[model samples]
Target: MAAREYGQYCGVTQALELVGERWALLIVRDLLVGPRRYGELAEGLPRIPSNILAARLKELQAAGILRRAPRSRVVVYELTPYGRELEPVVLALGAWGFKAMGDPRDEQVVTPDSMTMALRTAFRPAVAAELPATSYAARLGAAELLVRVDGARLDVSRGDGPVDLSFAAGPGIRRLISGELAPDRAISTGVVEVLHGRGDLLARFATTFHLAA
Candidate 1:
């Protein structure tokens, strides 16, 4: 089926016409972090039906928002450069929604991509400059993320690598990162386990990312 349109020529309406469908923006959100194979996308968006997922991918591809290319004989979906221009928009939306978020319901799921994006959105360069260069290995269940902080730059990528600090991602970890809970409290409660590196490094990690007051 063709995408439903508001039949208006305004830019905002036109943009929404392209991306306002159910699960459309969330698909873009997942792809923003990195290229994902079909199964990986499905895993990230477990609530979306397979048929709907397939259809949305096709629609986005046709609209020039995303494209599929083969990597090592396996096809992966990724946003085109044009599509990536939506990063600021997505991040802004995330920041705006942060204050409105009350709590996670039982059915709500958190994926690695969402966590990565949250880190990206929460990063504070001014605060990061106060700390020395460091790298973090974040393990959330079976997912691993490598976060590197150099000067005022912060980079997050998938997979494990040699790092200065390592910790498990959980509710307490999320709270620490978001400033909802203090680092000391999280550690004392055993919510965040530091597998490697000094406790100071974990303290610095907490300072780097935070939600706006």
Candidate 2:
């Protein structure tokens, strides 16, 4: 009951047999952003045909990559606790691809790029080393954003109280941690803007974390 493939030595190959089909990984990636309804997932993943997307969601549900939950009597696909466990795996894959391309000086992760996934991957023990007991705020256009620290989680979209800082980098929240855009330059160009927080605190916080490219 090991689920081992008789002739497969590569673990990835065997795993792929279960989830390596077309657009399957993308489904998993979208789920990592947050819980989304079937229609929402389809909207986010426009390249996927509706019929294929539906099929893949069903397959993922069966394989435990996603779980179906009742949302207003309609089934919605959500990442299970087990499925959330794959965030690191997908992030690592994205970072590997970025580095493998051999262009460190450029912003490898761009808009419509999976920067959120990269940030999710990069926000680990090493990067958050000495994480001070402080919160961060990002002032996105027309939306006040706050990321409060809850142990290992960077709780997003709290949108509560006075924002400590602001990041106005379009929709690509993932680029900040993906190492494609410099935190400083991005600020200068208005892609990111810090409205509050002590400079010293911000500097220290910046040093303690990094976006995995």
Cα lDDT of all candidates, in order? Answer: 0.85, 0.62
Off by over 4 Å in 1: 1-3
How displaced is residue 4 in candidate 2, in Å? 17
Candidate 1: tens digits of C-alpha lDDT, residues 1-213:
344877677999988988889999989998999899999999999999999999999989999999999999999999999899989898888888876776577777778898788788888889888788889998765557899998899898987788998888565565776677787777777888888887667778889888863
RMSD of 1: 2.2
Q: What root-mean-square deviation over C-alphas does model 2 reach?
A: 5.3
What is the per-residue lDDT of model 2 for residues 1-213, given as tens digits with 9 covering 90 to 100? 444334677877867865778888888887887777888787767677999998898878888878888878787788888888877788778767755544334432232224445445555655454465556665433334455544556655534665455444454333544556666655666656666665344443454346444
